[model samples]
Target: MGYLYIFGTILFTVYGQLILKWRIEKYGSLPPLVKDKILFLLQLLVDPLILSGFLSAFVASIFWMGAMTKFDISYAYPFMSLSFVLVFILSVFLFQEPVTLYKVIGLSFIVVGIMITSQSV
Candidate 1:
């Protein structure tokens, strides 16, 4: 069950990050609000991508809390680093981002780290 929770956390984290990227692309960055900031905020909130991302993030937060309750932080936190690899893959497929050798090497290291940490757990 702990492993399941960990996997769920990883999924939630990855999906949450992807959604955030979608939101950013759809809505762009939040500009400095000098005046009529409330209207700007409202406009930002009305964006579908932003709303979906926010919802996914909220769900991820809840799953993360559940995972934390089920496992030691030391064990669980390292697993979250899986997001680095996940984001890389997602970026390549979803956004047509380049996957270079350096990125592959970095992702390999991330996998190695996760393996080592899993051994400890």
Candidate 2:
């Protein structure tokens, strides 16, 4: 059950991150230092794609938090790092983004990290 939670968290978290990336591509970044409510509202309303992405991401976050509560951070957090690999794969097909050798190497590292962390737990 703990493992299930961990996997679920990783899945949702990756999906959420991909959604966020899509949102960013659709709408410009919102700087933390900025305090303009009017501009924020305009951005929110003007970009439907960004809005959908935001909504999906918000839903995924709830699942992620629940998973965190059910598992150890040291074990679960490392597993979540696999999301980097997942997101890379997702972006390649979903968004037609380029995948390079460096990304493949990074994904290999993530897999190795997951294996090591699982053994530790």
Best-performing candidate as measured by TM-score: 1
Q: Count residue pairs with overlapping backbones in model 2.
A: 0
Q: Please give, for residues 1-121, the per-residue lDDT of candidate 1 as tens digits.
A: 6677777777877887787677667756566875666666788778777677677677767777888888888878888888889889998999899989999998999899888987853
Candidate 2, 13-116: lDDT as tens digits = 67666766776666565756556656865776567665665665666566667767887777678877877888888999989999889889889988998898
What number of clashing residue pairs does each candidate have, in the order they appear?
0, 0
Among all windows of 10 consecutive residues in model 2, the one with the lowest summed lDDT is 48-57
Candidate 2: misplaced stretches above 4 Å?
23-41, 45-49
Best by lDDT: 1
Per-candidate Cα lDDT values, in order, are 0.79, 0.73
- Residue 38 local lDDT, model 1: 68
Residue 64, model 1: Cα distance from true site in angstroms: 1.8
* Model 1 TM-score (2 dp): 0.79
Displacement of the residue 95 alpha carbon in candidate 2, Å: 2.0
